[model samples]
Target: MGLFSRKKEIMVGNICPKCNMEFSEPQRTLRHIEKAHKSKKKFECNSCG
Candidate 1:
């Protein structure tokens, strides 16, 4: 019945390897690692003639 539909709750079991944080979705966990744990590298351009 559309009137009495129950949504299943997802359990959070995904853990971040860097921070050990729990996330419900895998995507959120990956995002957290990229933002907090992983460091961003800057690229430098050199011109040679």
Candidate 2:
């Protein structure tokens, strides 16, 4: 028996410019960009110290 299920999954929404990451909410996409791409970490952990 050969039967194919007709199930389709589609993603249509905001996408990050820097990283092709998809987000359902536009706000989330913006936040992701600001946090991951735009913002810079001030402190860093050193193993020697």
Candidate 3:
């Protein structure tokens, strides 16, 4: 192996639904989604027109 040679990084984690960000840990991904994409309302309500 050369001095500058490096091993390839393997991504083994969950991906965010909203964004395509990868996380090594499931908990971290969940936390990031909650904090980054937190909705103002607890639930979304739809009304019939």
Candidate 4:
């Protein structure tokens, strides 16, 4: 793509009002807010750490 030829921003769902994070699905966006911003860490790895 050229410099002037920009890509389009597709909105599959709503953007997060709190952090301005874009998500394709509404459920996924909600989950992201809860996990990342709401201090709900539920998907931690034991071997990776």
Index of the highest-lDDT prediction: 3
Q: Give a tens-digit lDDT track for model 4, residues 1-49.
A: 5879865643436688778889878878867766777755667799986
- Candidate 2 stretches greater than 4 Å from native: 1-13, 45-49
RMSD in Å for model 4: 10.0
Q: Give the TM-score of candidate 2.
A: 0.53
Tell me the tens digit of each residue's lDDT in model 1 across 1-49.
Answer: 5898786554334898767889888878867776787575465457731
- Per-model TM-score versus the true fold: 0.49, 0.53, 0.53, 0.47
Ranking by TM-score: 2, 3, 1, 4
Q: How far out, in Å, is residue 18 in model 4? A: 0.8
Q: Which pairs clash in the backbone of model 4? A: none
How many backbone clashes are present in model 1?
0
The 0-to-1 C-alpha lDDT of every candidate, in the order given, reads 0.70, 0.73, 0.76, 0.72
Predicted structure 2: lDDT: 0.73
Q: Candidate 2 — which pairs collide? A: none
Candidate 2 per-residue lDDT over residues 1-49, each given as its tens digit: 4388664543335998778999889878867876898566777679754
